[model samples]
Target: MTGTPEQVDYQQLAAEIMERCEVLGRISADPDHLVRVHLTAEHKIAANQVEEWMKRAGLQTWTDAAGNVCGRNEFGRGSAPALLLGSHIDTVPDAGKYDGPLGVLLAIAVAELINNSGSGLDVPLELVAFSDEEGTRFGNGLSGSYALAGAFEPAWWDYTDADGITFRQAAIDYGLDPDKVNEAARRADELVGYLEAHIEQGPLLEDADLALGVVSSIATGTRHTVTITGQAGHAGGTPYDRRHDALVGASELVVGIEQICSTGGTIGTVGRLQVYPGGVNVIPGRVEFSLDLRAETSPQREAALAEIEAAAAEIAGHRGLGWEIEQFYTSHETACAPWLQGAIAAGIRATGQSEAPMIWSRAGHDGMAIDKITDIAMLFIRCAGGISHAPQESVTVEDVALALEAYEEAVRRSAAAAVAR
Candidate 1:
């Protein structure tokens, strides 16, 4: 991005990126070699593997209060603003190889390239392999980044996993100081920029025949639980109109909620549901369900939730039943910076693409939280069939190389800009 002639060796750099991926895949390959690193017992093994890998990469590593691992390529004592590149290594219960590991590996690969080059570019670079970014533990996404941004909730500490392990204990066991968790948050100005490389998590890039797609915006989402209460009676004893059937109420509201979200061109789902004392011969006494609503923007998503809430209220009131709703989580959209997008556009053209559209991320990512609070952006490489979070999640060696080029170029541009100013 800055230097002239042949300061960077693209071939060797690509090989290094691939090589790191290979080692990472090898060390963590457990059942079917899916490379899953959940926040459970396997987490200790996973973090140890990652830290050891960083050490092998000739980089200095440290863990923050939130369990985020930071590695630095320190060049000089001038305190040059850094180019922060990272993604989470933790995955769901089962996962593909490329989701979070690729970005972390590629960041180290980029650093290797810069270190090997005999150039004057000495801009400091930092690569992070964030802990708890997947939110697999305690159902909280972006745990590390949220803590780093000072947006972590105190209640998160009180959260006990299914096995009854508190967050504080987990931190302590993971070799972090539980008392200093809050000190890990960024002080509002320590970082210069951040970048994340991730799979598209969809089939769009592959369907459209593209090398890599740059992210434009992330969607805001709201998760709410709805409960309905009604009188329960024997099915044969109660007439249809006389029975205050909670199951029927819930089912009707489910359809109405579906129609409301769909008709408004918003995405929604009844992701979870349960009927109290579920039985075939009994009228339902209580029903509990969850609604997941998402939109390209916050206001739109909130509006759809309002429609769903109103629908639920009407359904409960019509049946002379009781109802209540509780919000689970709310995350807003994060917009990519214009110049950064343009810079990545230049990187895309460097790979001989005619155009690359700014695609939106439908699923929740650590990028969503970081981008909203920090100067962060992401790159989406095509996944096989756009599949993610499954055992079949795969990316090509060729595409990995292509993404490496774009990632390095983008990082170089940003780091060079840091040095320039």
Candidate 2:
């Protein structure tokens, strides 16, 4: 009993999405700023709001043990395998309103629209608003999705926040039973696949004059903390050829990293740096910095990292300095499921666009963690100028409308594919 595409009130849905984003934006821990981290009062508030909305959408909603808000529309087939849709809900400090919330709200809006249209999906549908994807509090991103994927690490229970709150204690304070956290893990047989609709968070679609694109893959990379150590000496006494200047060595390594990444397929960034013995007349004796290296594939990223490491060692040796690099984080690239990609492409074509663009997401996403367990696919909605993670991050109502249309179609197509299989 599904209705025609024109029967969908996309304009009203867009307005509602905007209104809800504003509402959640107001539910931040910082009354004067937008910072809602995991297991905090603001996180619980936002999850409650989303739970109410899910219930209103004719869904059986609940907050998972990991604090993720979830809803499911079984459509008469109880406990059936479902197509999962969602994105994370937590935000970084002083973050924009839409990054994570947009996808979750869009999924709920699609559900409400279908319910109102007197139509039903051929397959079960489940929506999740993941609780902690930004990892602002614990330095461990994708906690919600990782738990859902049955990948939660026990060591994380002891992880502490900036306020010295342990992850387990924070969960308890948020009114969740930390002992039952393992119950949040979903078995592999529980889902058909996962689909997430998120902002492009980049300039590719806008530059191409398009409103949406299907993601081909998520980026893979390595992260490290690098330290270069040398001898400190008076600035006047340190000779150009005889002195071991750690800051100079670090500066050279930064330039070398840029050169390595500039070869065109990788991205390298030195986001943080610190120098020891800060003084006007003292040469820096020790320097520490951060490196975020990324590429579309593991091999490519590893190659770039190897080149950077070799260069670092060579430069440190030439400068007569001691150097060490401690690798902290690494994630392999995740490619979208082929059939899911086909479904997304079909959905894009339904919007009067003969050519649906494909792009790789340079930014990390929950899909990174979820992909470890289930097939994951993502739709990228165009933003104004490809900016994200900042207050200026924005998307138009029209763009959201298009995103909704494509998202719904993709869901329907995925349902059909599931039935066929």
Candidate 3:
């Protein structure tokens, strides 16, 4: 963490990235502006935006078949593995300020410093901007990072977005050839390590008044689609005892998930629901819903999911109803490399913060996806009031500056390690 401290005017670079994000015009669920619906034009806008930023930094574009943007700087290439810094550019519907943009910008900032370094350190660095981590278009997150880690399976080409656009079609529309997606992926051996900087998305550091957190593990998630069916009858019904109501049963399922997660760190949600053939007078013959569960470990996550599923089945059996279930996805727990964690802590010490370097991630990230294939690490900046995913989402500019400093140090250490090989 020493060595004359590679320096740059971080404040200027951060302001530039923030301003670029600020000018993107309310990038919500617009087809033309790439709202929830992927109009294809959206990728162009984002790519061009990212391109403009890197170009301003005097770096050239290095795009791939998956639409991932790579910017590279060669310092007379020595025998060093490339240091990789990555984060996605896609956002949830009507996303807020710093969720993904900060990571992309910070990576660019790191590159800018390396580009200007007169010392010509032993390593070469690459700044990567991943596309479609939000899953707003395809309902599956981390597409670009998946490809970069060689984790994107070919079957995903058939995935369809909300508008009936398949992932293959969307890739074609985005100026990438579906036939060449396999070529888009990186060699697993070529990457040395990866790092991402993201807003904490929780209130931990905010409440504790800490400047930054070096993430120790990225939390895992389990998702399920559940359906319940029962007899349809008049709202008044033939008789209370004789009537079977799916709506009423669904209500119970919702509460059951809540009850399972009341223990604190465990989390569950029945976020989406639909009742068939809608009418107030109807008894609701069918109901479909979703289940979301999260935990620090697989056992805890599996237990929570199993409990919820069991409760649904029991309620159905007691009410003379039928149910069906389909699992959507599950993420395995991703742990940070301890060596990388220590280097980040050293970065924190450089910034003069003394609190035990906090480390935890409940939100899913591109880092988690990459962890499935390579060594990965992350840093979390506190979000205000423990709130995120809304326009009101915020982080202190001062804290952001500290993160820029810390991540730069992290990038340097990672590069230094890679160059040692």
Best by TM-score: 2
lDDT of 2 at 119: 67
Runs of candidate 1 with Cα error greater than 4 angstroms are 1-39, 120-122, 317-320, 419-421
Q: List lDDT for all candidates, in order.
A: 0.75, 0.89, 0.75
Candidate 3's residue-wise lDDT over 35-116, tens digit each? 4233367656776777777765556677887888787665777544666787777766656767887788877766666566
| TM-score for candidate 1 | 0.89
How would you encode candidate 1's per-residue C-alpha lDDT over 126-155 as one tens digit per residue? 778888777766788888888777777777
Q: What is the lDDT of residue 7 in candidate 3?
A: 45
TM-score of each: 0.89, 0.96, 0.92
By lDDT, the best candidate is 2
Summing lDDT over every window of 10 consecutive residues in candidate 3, give the lowest-scoring window: 1-10
Model 2 over residues 1-421: C-alpha lDDT tens digits? 1234667667667878988999998998888878999998888889999999998888898889999999999887688789999998899999999999999999998887766666678888999999999888999999999999989998899999988999999999998888888899998788888999999899999999999899999999789999999988999986888799999999999999999999959999999999999787999999999999989999989899889989999999899999988999888999999889889889888877777888999989998888877788999998889989888889989878778888888999998898787
* Better by TM-score, candidate 2 or 1: 2
- Ordered list by TM-score, greatest first: 2, 3, 1
